[model samples]
Target: MPDNKTGPFLQGITRLLTDGTLGTTDIVESMHHRIVHPPLLPSTPIQHLITGIAGITYRNIKWSTRLIGKGIDKSLYKLAPFLGEIKDTPKKVALVSILNGILGDYLEINNNPLAIQMNLKNQDRDTSIDASSQACELRNVKGRILIMVHGSCGNDFQWNQEDHNHGIALAEKFDKTALFLNYNSGCHVSSNGKDLNKLLERLIYIWPVPVEEITIISHSMGGLVTRSAYHYGRLNDNGWIKHCSKMVFLGTPHHGAPLERIGNYLDTILHVIPYTTPISKLGKIRSAGITDLRYGHVVEEDWKDRDRFELSGDQRNIVPLPDGVECFAIAGITGKTSDKPSIRKSGDKMVSLNSALGIHKDPEKSLEFKKKNTWISEETTHSELLSNKYVFNKLASWMK
Candidate 1:
């Protein structure tokens, strides 16, 4: 075998191109079919012939594309080992991460190489916790561990935005081991949550030192993943969950993000229309993870047996915060003060303040975090939460 470490990730582009071509052909052919046989219109033999010919041409194109895609895929694999393991640049990582966040579920279903596998970030590349050769990541490792989870389209490296990383800073300050989880954010939070639970189980079993405490600091969609993981931990009776002591959420959209709702609206509108219906495929391109954010779904019960794209109101059974864990929330706002909680635009541009704080109008849906445990940061954007000194201070204080 050759040293083709990059093959696992870069090969995804071939599959992506093939899929894109097929999908584009589908949309175009659908429009052609609709035009030739308009809704509620009579059909003719000429139209049938035209449509059949078009269909055959499209099928041939798709078949050829698939064949070529497979050929390139095999070639890349054979050629990869000789290329050696080309270290992934930050730019490439960001591109791949963003791609996964948008079409992760699709990539996963299709077995595309681009789909990011959930793993613990150790040194340069990610390594599974249960590997025989444990990662010598830290010295004098303690039971106090901090798990960092980044949001949609984000990777563990993103936690260190602009040369400062909350996970590293907190670990240094508190003398604990900080482990960053890198996962495909486009998968359903429930799936990622379950995976994280399993990873933690293995981590605890293989830890160099006895596990005593675990802290999770999450941002954006990452918070939802963390919440789901805790629920699974308890549901499966995973013993490692007992060590989870504190969870800090930064700009997490506990209720739902307005942007995804808007995207849902667009998908709905396009789908309902006749001409634009086919184009709605672009809207439906959103991953299951993004749709789960339609209502901050954190479990299988929340989305199973339902069309995720349907404009269903929040019918999900309200899940309260995980019990026995001191949960702290930090809602960043673009405004100077958080006096206007009801204002739609006061949130950190991505998450509304009320949603970030888990303040649903329905009493049953509210998470019930104490006032002292939550902080509202002003003049901050969602992306700024990672490196913001104030946010880090609040997280450190909560841990203390």
Candidate 2:
């Protein structure tokens, strides 16, 4: 039998409730322990049981908060004109707090869950691909292999949409094969990148036929993963670079997203509360999602011109880039200003025009690719940039 923490935990809770041994501090301490020491088997039966119990607790708190937010949103939407009529800090704070609550709810609930699981399959099946002689049957007959890496909180299905998922479109356009690289966004950047590089090395070596080319189109944090994978591939002399012919970045924060810093502030404040541990995990700067957005943890001297943010390796170009690879970037500009309307003007609320297009050389600027190699679209949001019609065409054009 498994060493069951949940079994004991549940029994303890029952006993505490019956004997009145459980106090708020005791409950809080138990929860804190569980949160800090996440189970090794997230999906194990015991873990699932514990998670279900926790989920119920979460629902109670979340529902109350959500209802309050709904009420506040209704009030705010109705009080649009009243903002000018009343000049009070308390009101302003209340309105701001309401807006924040609503935004948080929308972000959490509106995300595409189908896209989250599109590439997830039996991990065992993936590992066994190497053992089978027929592992790469599709690649052997195909002329090229297209690997797709998705952005933050995105999945392969995000690329499956006819309008936005570029990898599927490219496969049909080129009659080539494709593979979706799926990974958790919560780990460390270098760790995930190294794993991707290793996977790529295995795929290429087992490929049954000559791979004419290997092309990648990455969005947001995916771009950073691409770079990190390339860096590790070269650093380890993994030879995965030999298969890569082209790469494209869409709305990638080559430097870093200012909003993330803002999020860090918000997360810091939220973390002080005992109820916010799950939400707080999303903002750790060292998380793979965050690190990729910031590139590396440390900035390198050489990258100072291209990327202004200081990551651990931001100043060092120590990571070797793929040889003879074509790199292109497409930036988004919703509008010109930082005002709400500016989001409509140049950037995808999350990323700005200058940052998207690699226009500013101050922080590290993007490499100057040939006109045919680069694509810029200011009309799309960061999320929408990946599937823009013109952007897809540009990616296809480059491959040709």
Candidate 3:
């Protein structure tokens, strides 16, 4: 649901604009300084004059933006109640989800109302707001439960694309309840994982029926979150894990995504030059969740006390498929089965085959799924996996 205080979104934008203005001023001043005094030269007195003036100007701009932002917040708060129910339309949800995926931690730290709070929903209705209310909503719920977890920058509704929804379809066919995990994809995956553990615990407690079996079908980053949730659930002895029977991962980067690695590379390369150093900050603007994808990080220990933007190699802790659970993985390729090594390596044009299959050069790092449990889809893109009939067929076979 869209927050009644839609003003924070405007405030967020205003704050970003203010930040951009200040950042631009600094970059321009730095360029001027570099031009005035080349790399090897000593600091000139002219440099100090330019630096001091820019500093004072930026300070005033900062002060002014702060005042303006406060005023906007006050006005928006006063006017929010009259705006009626701000609908979470598809387009609006997409834009906001994308924003959160890019600046989620930033939004949370700054208390931006646009930040998404994780929730579980059934048929577009929330189920975790309270136990009694959830019981009423899920009065006819079944014992078998199938949870659908969507990828980054995605909402649970995106699963219902092309007039087809795998979650609803599977639930209907198998006579089970379907729940969707909707969450901010920009926060640390571990934090979301822990939250998911608590959510599952509460969900089952308030469920109208005793959950006989729990199965999760996750995509991309959602897979990492599922794995992390299970890890925490096991450590905390959460009852939800005992009911978990199976997990199906669709195009999950169990190892890491090459795109984020490339982003990290660019961030590092640009940071080397004075002219482009400021530009490097733009690369670093991606969310903490994105940085986690660089190595499929899913635990706090993996990212704690570390500079996420540093051009670091894969230093992620090895997390394997959970024990006593049937784990399955699926990778999609945009080409035929007979495609070249390059095509195979570029699985789905987003995640690679090896990463999706949890295949690592180091044996210990590999997730070691049963060979028969993995499936590869040909001539398919990452987004198409959601609606692909062939993919659904394979998933159905596994579900059966």
Candidate 4:
């Protein structure tokens, strides 16, 4: 699916040479950002879509999961020692909102505004032009845009430009428009999906000229948001899905993260103590930390349509790709080795090969890749999948 244009190819190759080497600090910065900013609850978009309100609702429920066991209260106190390790989530959310708001307002159209009117009317004619002519016309066509959706606790800045992350490399290689998706990771996946749908609707409606294509590359929980946007967010309502020719997911837990379950279990153990004053009235399941820890929210039975998805058995699957979209996924794994480099060996401290691949209690219901989209690299930790050269190149090849 690589673009037929040479301009993008030259631009990409030029950037690769100019950027030179990647830095370790840059890699750490990317990881640091993911540890802090979780996305908003998925319900955030539901409210907006159904009720036309932008606010979130909370219902406080005691952490009853802890009350089921004996002597667990004393054990819970032991975990108190670990509570200090939880990062400053609130500040992270604030920073993410600020950063994304800035990008959406600034980079989206600030430098190269779209044309006054853009639609599919003359696309066939436009496609007939030569490469140079097409390049010249594209200069006036507003750059090709890639909308990136970050995983839970992720920010737009998480993909460091200097690093090997997929978004950065794809942006560099394509020389198209690139916009990072930043949202409250604490929100529910479905909510964010709906919000994204709305956001896309607004973007196209207001685009300077007719948009030809849009690519969405997401990581971890971000993939769920992307799916939810498609399934429930009404993205196809306005030809949005048609515009999205490519979708790439990097280590996205299609089934949900196993680490989240562990954290939720531990949190339940901590909530039993009567002395532990709850910081917010939000329900235990609804809290930002616990929600991600628990994966997607359990809704009505109809919502758990198992037949709707495909699994990889271990991080691979022929995802229920939206109609008309070319979808693929990249998963990170820690190679079995004694001398592996630091970045290559670790699967982002949080996500592991098992979880990244969506291997869960029900292996039968996991996502299976129709074909190996491409194994980017086993060296990078989970978070580094997007930056890895192998993955990015394969993706760039697909995009073209």
Pairs that clash in candidate 1: 2-81, 3-81, 4-80, 4-81
lDDT of each: 0.87, 0.55, 0.85, 0.50
Number of the top lDDT candidate: 1
Give the Cα-based TM-score of candidate 4 against the true structure: 0.54
Off by over 4 Å in 1: 123-138, 338-346
What is the lDDT, from 0 to 100, of the residue 334 in candidate 2? 61
Off by over 4 Å in 4: 1-143, 161-169, 233-236, 271-293, 296-319, 336-348, 358-364, 374-376
- Expressed as tens digits, the lDDT of each residue in 1-400 for candidate 3 is 3446455555566666655676666676666666766776687687778777876876787678768766776776776656565466778788878888888888788777778888888875644432223443565789999999888888887898799999999998898889988888999999889988888888888777778999999999999999999999999999999999999999999888999999988988899986677677778778999989999998999999999998888888877789999999999999987978987889999899999999999999999899999999999899899999998998899988
lDDT for position 174 in model 4: 78
Per-candidate TM-scores read: 0.94, 0.58, 0.93, 0.54
Q: List pairs with backbone clashes in candidate 3.
A: none
Candidate 2 TM-score, C-alpha based:
0.58
Give me the candidate number with maximum TM-score. Answer: 1
Candidate 4 lDDT (Cα, 0 to 1): 0.50
- Backbone clashes in each candidate structure, one number apiece? 4, 32, 0, 52
Q: What is the lDDT of residue 314 in candidate 4?
A: 30
For candidate 2, the lDDT comes to 0.55
